[model samples]
Target: MNVLLVKDDCGRSRKTCHMPTHTAIIALTKGGKQLAQRLKTLVPGSEIIPNKGKIHQTFAQAWQDHDSLICIMATGIVVRSIAPLLQDKTVDPALVVCDEQGRFAVSLLSGHLGGGNALAQKVADVLGGQAVITTASDVLGHTALDLWCRDMGLAVTDKQGLTRVMAKLVNTGSVTLYSEYPLPPLPQDIIPSRTLDAADLLVTSRIRQKENIVLLHPKALVAGIGCNRNTPAKEISEALDHACRTHQLARESVRNLASIDLKSDEPGLLAFAHAQNLPLDFYSPDQLNQVEGVAASAAVLRATGAKAVAEPAAILSSGGGPLLVQKMKFPNVTVAIAEILQPFPTLF
Candidate 1:
């Protein structure tokens, strides 16, 4: 993965982003050599790009070239630099903000799947500072629904169904059960679809063609996340990938993307959410909070207030297993994806 490090104000110009398959580090400053030196020590082999103008100018230039952005500056500067880069079509690099003192590191964007969350943690570890991570699943250290699907080798056939199942799991910690064949009872709903092909049925239960059976299980929740305007889709995708890798899960089982009502119209997020045939579930902040064990970040808490732990936490907590996917970043935005899992039906 190519990482970009930008520091403004270094006297000389160095283009490390051009290196073959390496992470680029751009240091933004008003012409300071110290920043460059500091970044070199922090991220070895990282390309250092210097901009002597405002942070936005540096971002404008480097924003188009990097996969992830780490800001070793104050929070205000970090926010100002990225303000202009936010957009729908662009997969924004994961954004991390760190103070010069490096006392606390915050992942302002792409905390879950986008890698910013993980990156922030890594930077904090390196700097010997506290990484203020706020993702619910990370704090809880439990398997999410998407992670479960990936682990079990199942495919998501219906995004809507998956979303519904996840929401219920987060809210009530359980889901209604249903099935079509004489399969062993599962903990959740197991509605057999006539349109489902043999391949769709990963487990064989009493081979009935069209029967309606119901099972209820508590471990079938899912997670859903959204990104800021223009956040890179790639960042979100990477986050999901990292989540899966961290949990040793698979990718084929993810079912849907969840977000607030406002983000439902975001073209970039919608494109990703729909592409996987993942259902898009939009809820109010209040509705989101029904999920248990979800950690709320300052950004998510501020935006949604008491809603839910932002969209990502709800998805992460609701999902029963590890994370199925990570966040993908676009020009300026990122998103999270996951799958829901239920018990395999057996007929004997």
Candidate 2:
């Protein structure tokens, strides 16, 4: 994780610059020079970035570029400088603030979602100071949903639902948690319920349009693709979307896209996979044909020496699972989907 250190005053902070080498320090000149020297002594390999322009602009850029920001400046100054750029918790970087003396590290924003609270503790440890974390979930010992989702690699489907449920949970302790996936040891606030009909928060890989239900999609599905030569990338993408839509599958759960080795060099297929940010796995015709239970097509068998393209590819990619979608032939592409089978028990 990249960290950016911004200090407005340099002279006094020079000795305190003994931060870790991975940290990038933005030193405001004049008063910042001495602080930079001090920091350099403390942190041997950490590089210092000269404050080139407006402080707010630097803060904004650092927020985008780094995973965390350690502001060795006044909390008020850091707050105002970063206020304009403050956005959603899901994407914002962890923000930690320390006094000019580097005493009392404070987690000012994104305590859980961006790991600000954790960073505050680390910074406080480095400075021989105290970490002040004010997030209610952390202070009260309740579950931080955003942090949990991030750690589990689950994507939030209904962020508004999450906020609404969180308000109810924090204010009235009225939220039920249910999951179709494996359960982790949860806080008392997130009580398990048996049914989605009674849940405020739902965790699954399926698409749901119900109001006030925050869906946490686990990465579980693999998609297989078979396209004719010269097929446009858009067609391949659209076909996959259609397949997912038909099955009410959350497209976010797609782990990767699999195709035959013959299509490995197919520009359109490769481009589509890259654009979708889905890893593409290409299997040999022998490997594809080895899989059973796929509907055979004469044209596909003759062309690629495989019984089917999409079905076998999907099954193989998922490491042998029941096909969630059989080979679906579109005008330019054939698509299939399969859920990766796991030993997740349904109940206690």
Candidate 3:
């Protein structure tokens, strides 16, 4: 949790300045020294970076580095500094604004906008301050549809589109969710208005519903793995992380865990497959032989007792191809990640 703190117009370090992990404090006045000392007492491991110039420079630098912003300055200064950064969707970080006294913490931008609201609450709790959360669903104690989609590892293709849908949901007190399979149970307070069949949904899920409904697709990211017998679970986990980052795919989107049948019972693969909460599908030797363009090594073939030389390639094709491949040296394993591409119907 990286935080960026800015000084207020009064040019004073509030006694409430406490640092957490990966914290950076930027001040427009010389007051940063006092804040840094207080932060060191609160968070020994925190890093405090001070600037006594314009607030916008600090904001721009923080934005460029993609750090979450926690403004301890005036509300107007915080607002002005963040306005430009908000326009570009790709670079925005969670933005939280707190008074110099730290009595009230407000989530001004990225409130469910980009996870700022949740971060604000967490920061407020740490400081023993009041979190002035304004997101309507959160204030009403209703399940937030966008947050739900994020939790399910589904991407929200259009933010404005989701906004419109949420507005409808707020007014109607009803929204539909579509899925090809039965969804995991939702909060009991949420009642389904109706279930209709339509091809358009905001997120990934096999189910479809009529207008004014939210759709949750099953996991769309597939993990195709090839591991050695009795491989360590840590190696497999690291391989999965590497592959996911290499492919620029969210770890949460991983829907299916796949491997060769010979290694299905391997403890490492089994544990990793289960931990991700995805279905583990094993491919038989014959099935491994069927995938085209697979590069198998003699060592892999002999170790797995498979007729084919490349177990990783087979796993990818079986799981779905154009997969991200990660070769492990310790356990002599390889992992692949594939992103499911689904066609969505236009919702007018």
Candidate 4:
């Protein structure tokens, strides 16, 4: 895939396969234009959209091009211009409204998951103003569930359930929390539940279909794989999928792939990893030998100088974590899975 060069907040160049618009600032009046220009310099990776006199047309053009939009116009004007382009909150860009005098930055749309509140605060900081955030959780000084999921890289299973749980959090100021892995410090509003049945929010790799519960799947599993030479990519993918399904694991939680260095250039493994957008790590035979308690195969030892490939590689990639799935063999593939145990974000 072709790559693009992007600049970060520190003005450092980074390579990316896709170039998403970082930020776009649009303004109408002269004072608003001046504020937009100042923000272009203050906010990293931000650019001012040239106003062509037709403010609605400019907003329409920017709505599809940017991940974040800062409108230096009246809040009503912004709402009207973006109404037609509005879609699901998950897909909509961060919308922030700032006064022409740079007195206040309002998080008008997509505040939690879209990061509009953070952007508003940043703009206010740069302009010496105050940020107006109206989210119920933020106003009540409680941890926003959606923002927590975003920061922890969790995938919510049910959107409507999450909304209901957020409302419950704001109304009652507490929700039961359950996790399969260790967690960071909990706030007063998050009461830990000992069982999944009694929990209102769950963090696990298991699939659940119950209602009135917000389920979040963490990217915590590492799949180690070994395949016969010249195996097809489709076969390898199906083998992994079968393994995950058989073990009742969520496919979204498989973080990466691990294999021996001898198969580093294997076309099947490379293609599967690329299609899944998962990182692939390779280890030497000596490193694999260091991992004990794995099923040793004489044929694998003779061919690759390692007694086991899939099980040890999974353990190594997971930072020496215990295996969740022991080695399973298919016609042309061997697979193992391990939970990645590491430090989580303590900010929550």
Candidate 1 residues lying further than 4 Å off, grouped into runs, are: 1-36, 42-45, 88-90, 142-348
Ranking by TM-score: 4, 2, 3, 1
In order, the Cα lDDT scores of the candidates are 0.50, 0.74, 0.57, 0.86
Q: How many backbone clashes does candidate 1 have?
A: 103
The residue-by-residue lDDT of candidate 4 on 240-268, one tens digit each, is 99999999888888887888888877888
Please give, for residues 1-348, the per-residue lDDT of candidate 3 as tens digits: 222223334231111123233434444434435543554455334445555577778788877564465666677887877777676433466677766554667887767746678767765676677888888888877667677766655655456667776665577665555444334565544443334453224344222333554444446656667766787878888877776566555565566666666665678766665555455656666666666555656776676655442334324433344544433333456766554444122111
Index of the highest-TM-score prediction: 4
Candidate 3 lowest-lDDT run of ten: 10-19
lDDT of 3 at 71: 64
What is the Å distance of residue 181 in model 1 from its true position? Answer: 17
**Count of backbone collisions in candidate 4:** 0
The model with the greater TM-score, 2 or 3, is 2
Error of 1 at 60 (Å): 2.4
lDDT of 4: 0.86
Which TM-score value belongs to model 3?
0.56
Which candidate model has the greater lDDT, 3 or 4? 4
